[model samples]
Target: MNDHPHQSSSLTAQAGLPSELNQHNRRADDSAWIEVVQHMDSIYADLVHYQVELEEKNSALEDAQLFIQSVISSISDILIVCNINGEIQQVNHALEEIIGKTAEELLDKPISSLFCEQHLSLIAEFPEHIRSGSLIDCQIELISSEQKEIPMAINCCARFDHENRLSGMVVTGRPLGELRKAYSALHQAHEKLKTANLQLIQSEKMASLGRLVAGVAHELNNPISFLYANMHALKNYQQKFKTYIDAVHVNTSHDELQKLRSQLRIDAMMDDINPLVEGSVEGAERVSEIVQNLRKFTTPQEQKKQSFNLILVIKRAISWVLKAAKTSPEVIHNYPAELNIISNEGYVHQILINLIQNAIDAMDHRGQSKLVITVNKNDDSVQLHIHDNGPGIKQQNLVKIFDPFFTTRTVGSGTGLGLYISYGLATEQCQGDLTVSNHKDGGAEFILSLPLEAGK
Candidate 1:
């Protein structure tokens, strides 16, 4: 009985050991299954993130394609994108409409097919030329859908890829007919502008002349009256001489002849004749000079320039302007006796007259008005400075002083083109410059610079 109980106890222990081993193996397998599940979850998360990024990139790509299409469609000039082999890869709407073909019909076609037979050789050479440098404004003939030849000015440049290699050519063209029309319209506008400018200048000149008419009349009257008085005195002296000679010829007594001579004042008349004649001649010459100056100012500017005495011109301009001026400003001349230059004399005269007139106008109502004119010589140019002791030009007005029709004068008192025209004539016609500024001593100063030689 004791041996049987020991055997049973041994069997129970072995059975218990197998049961513990199975439980440990089951726990270890559960842990491994949890680890596998975690790894799968991590991989799934990465796949979802990658998918979202791909969608965003696809959206951006779509936007870029739409933008490119819109730009290509909106271009007015015909555009063609070709491969390196000169085969058309893409084209704009303008090209489609101009060639009367759809993109589907034109794609992959040889570039030579779009051009006329005569231009095929030139079009072939374009690729070679484009490799070296771009082809600009090359005139060529294109073949339309109806096989009609159309003239075009085309520019071709090599298209580059991301690697900076020339992958293809991009050609843009405009119709020659449209270009010619544009040029014609521009030319017409330019001509009209020139005509209007000329009209303005002439109108201003006439206005200036009109303003000076009273002064000119008064100027003419002085010499004329002097001439008339001298002529009258000469006539009376002639009559006296005639009477005395007739008495002598009639054989009157010498005493009676001497009495007649005394009554006629013959000795005094002889003494006065030479001086009166000289005065009359001087008066006539003065009248002639005034008339000549007036004529020059009135005449249209000559095409050919001439060498003239600038000092004399300034003096004449001053005389003309001062005569018409309501106020008498003391003019100080700070220049040599004469300065000669080669230019349009009439233009210079007009410019000086306008400047001087402006100065005089500025000095109106001012006390003790003074004008100082100075000339300075340079190596290749001459500068004339006209300064006036009057209310200086406002800082704001200085910049706009040369603008057309800009004025500070009362209504109808001025046309405001005087300075503008003067500036234009100085800079454009004479190849010179004119500027204005406030003087240090309190006045407006105008500086005019002229080149010594004529502009070619």
Candidate 2:
């Protein structure tokens, strides 16, 4: 009975041990399952964040691609991107339209295939030339899809990669037909502008002439009146001499001839005759000179340049301008007796007249107006300085003075083209320069620099 009870206790202990073991195993399993679930949740969170970041990056990449495509499509110049082997890799919309093919169809095409057969040798040399340096305005004929040859002015430059190594060449060109059209339009516009400029110059010249008409008339009247008076006196003297000569020819006695001479006052008439004759000749010469100056000023100048006396032209200009000037400014000339130069004398005369006139106009209403003109010789040029004792050009107006049609004067008093045309004539026609600045003294100074004759 003791052995059986021991066996029962042992069996009971063993069964209780099995139940405790099962409970321990379940707790351990629950802990492991909880750890696995926490790990899975962390991984899912990371994956979600990465997915969002990837979507944003993909959106940015798409935007960049669209921007590039739009730029390529918007270009008007035909653009071709090629590989080192001279095979076209990509092309812009202009190229696509010109070639009459889609981008897909043109891809991988040999660049030389687009050019005419005559230019194949030159086209083959382009890669080597581009590698050395950029080729600019290279004119070649391109073949269209229809086999028509189209002239093109293409510029090529080496295309470099991120590594700074030249990979291929990028070619950009425009059809010559389009370029010719643009050039033709530009030429037409230039022609119109030239015509308008000529008209403006003529109008300004006429206005200047009109302003001086009264002075010119007065100038002519003085000599003409002198001539008239001298001619009338000569006519009376001739009549007296005729009566005395007729008396002598009629075989009058000595006493009678002496009486006739004394009666006619022949000796006195002789003295007056020389004076009248000299005076008439002087008046005639004066009239001739005035007419010549007017003809020179009014006539159309020839294009050919000639050697002329600069001093004489200046004096004549001063005389003409001062005669018509509303203000009687004192002019001081400090120059050599004569300075000869090779240029268009008429243009120079016109320029000096305009300058002198402008100076006179500026000095108008100013008390004791004075003009000082100084000439200096340089290595290759001569400078003529015209300084006026008037209020210097306004600081704001100085820059705009040479601009066409820009003026500060009253509307009808000036055409504003005087200085502009003067500048053009100085620079363009005479191969000289005209510049102005405020003098150190209280005045405005204009400097005209002109090239000297070849040897003198």
Candidate 3:
């Protein structure tokens, strides 16, 4: 009966144990669920923080982009972006403002189309320049929507991608109207300064020449006067001797006369004395004429307009040149005997002397020299040609022959001032033109054209 009771109690305890275990298992499950909920809440909070941070970063990126656009739009210089093919891809507001065209209209157009002819031609070289990674500053002209041309100075550089590959170009332009105007003014000023310098140099040359001529004339005056006086005295003595000889009596002994003639050497003296005296007189007169000519050259030339024989002046110049050169080259004067022109005689003389002397010098260099002078007269002007059979001037040096201090002769053999002064006298003083060229034959020909009534 005790074993029965113990078994019943064990069953009861087992039933109570089931209930107790059920309660304990429920509490453990609740604790585990609470921990799982806490872990999920923590994960949700971290995700929310990440989303908020991402949104803030996106907003900052947008602001930076907007700031760059504003800066590019506000800039006054035209900013252009072109693709590798030089096609316009983007342009700033400044470009639209300058050309009065919207970016939409220019988006696919060629960048070269906006440039003028000259700059358009340079488009073919743009790729090479870009390839070299060089910045080019070019003067270009831009055409506006209304067809107005605007000058600009553009600075262009190549653009590259993040991978360092050429993608496009960036160009900035500035208006160049004011700069071009400034440059033009500077160029004109430089030309004026050059002209003034040439005039000053010419003035100095004339002044020096005047001083030299004055000194030479002063020195020659005394000698020429003495020579002239002595010549006249010798002539008078010859005349007296002739009278005395004529007064000799006819009854004089032949032997006595023969002895007198032998003692005096009368025949030989008579044959030589007159020519010697004539030559001396002629030389003195020539010296006197040269002195006068020198004085005329130095003195202030008055435009004392008068009618004078041109042929006579030419002959006088030729004579003076022949005397100075001491060589008789054939000079053919093809002109009217008494062609007269109204001008300053002294200046004309100066011109002819210079031309003739140049011709003579040229002839001096040749084995067989010839000079042919021809004159042509029309109602308005006269043209004189001095042609010589000497080596012609080089084609390269022809243009510079009249420039001051330009010469091909040895240093002391020629003063380069001759042709320059001749040109100046012909153009400025005589109101004429002097030009030179090689003749058909192997020689140089100088043509001088003068208005009949210069200064009229």
Candidate 4:
């Protein structure tokens, strides 16, 4: 051991003494040191590898988390997460802004409290969709802190856990207040349309009634003329009676006067009571009938359907037109059998009055006025034809005849809404068709076809 530069290092080889032993000792010693050094190098390399790989994995995970958060905050709509029990777990700032409530206040509160009475039941149904893992798109109203209601369309989807249990829901809300406003505007427009339609019908009815009144006045003329003539006769008889009385007074009853009084029953000629009573009663009855027709025509009876004599309505319509026009428009009605068409009698009269009056007006610019009306029936329908020997409609204007506010007459003389309303009633309500055309016979004819028994 003392022979070497370091006695301890050489001592072991000196003890071996032989060449092979010394070489063996050196080899064993070198091998042992080399193995130790190699083990240390391998351990160092493993530590370096683990450190770099861990750092790279950590950076990747951080990037992924950042990407998720970016997506969550970037969207426009309100994003909310709710548990299956309907408690808000998380909500974005947009939802908080809309509700005017912080996420702190929303947590643990039932999601239903934010909705009004109308949406309460709807919200209750959301859990069903959540449990079924179904998506629901519904329009709902959210009550805000300021007491203002906000409409939203909730697009909700189910979120499940690892075990497939209903864990929560993810909902994205889209504002619907503007859409609601649009729908409301549409509804108001619809109501306005209804009002306009009703007004059209009322205007048509008034025009018809005016014409009917004129006709009734004309119809009363015959009875009035007869009554006046009868009264004149009565006056003459009175004068004769007075003369006989005077004769009796002057001559103490001349034989001729006395004989005449006895033969003619002059004793019963006290103011001609019998003729006066009969004529007055008859004339009063006629006036009453005419007045009744006018009343019925003007009545708002279209609200209820009724069965009435179609012939009576036609008569009233003719009377009204004739009375109002007060012209020599020769109107001829050719009808067979009595008609009892069941419908709104008022509107029936309205349609007829419009057609007849329009016919008269068409002839107003002409010298010779003539009209022909024909009423005929088939097995299930009635046909009414009104013809006027007036200037026929021009080819260009035929299509626009039924348009509202379109008139050929001078301003203030016609409203132009007549044919439009009449056409509507005859076709839409009466289940009938009304059309105008130039007849082969030279005049214009307005034809109305209506069902006799059943109506639309």
On TM-score, the candidate that comes out on top is: 1
lDDT of 2 by residue, 273-361 (tens): 88678767866876786677568656855456888889988986786566445668888999999999998776677678778878888
Per lDDT, the best of the predicted structures is 1
lDDT of each: 0.84, 0.82, 0.78, 0.77
For candidate 2, what is the lDDT?
Answer: 0.82
Provide the lowest-lDDT 10-residue window in model 3: 214-223
How do the residues 369-422 of candidate 1 rate in per-residue lDDT, one tens digit apiece?
A: 999999999888999999999899999888899976678999877767778878
Scanning candidate 4 in windows of ten residues, the lowest lDDT window is: 1-10
Cα lDDT for residue 453, model 3? 87
User: Which wins on lDDT, candidate 2 or candidate 4?
Assistant: 2
Number of the candidate with higher TM-score, 2 or 4: 2
Clashing pairs in 4: 1-11, 211-320, 212-320, 214-323, 215-319, 215-320
What TM-score does structure 1 among the candidates reach? 0.47
In angstroms, how far off is 183's CA in candidate 2? 0.9
Q: Alpha-carbon error at 341 in model 4, in Å?
A: 6.4
Name every residue pair that clashes in candidate 3. Answer: none
Superposed Cα RMSD, model 4: 16.3
Q: Compute the lDDT of residue 233 as modeled in candidate 2.
A: 77
Per-model TM against the reference:
0.47, 0.43, 0.43, 0.38
Residue 270, model 1: lDDT of 98
Q: After superposition, how far is residue 348 of candidate 1 from its true place, in Å?
A: 26
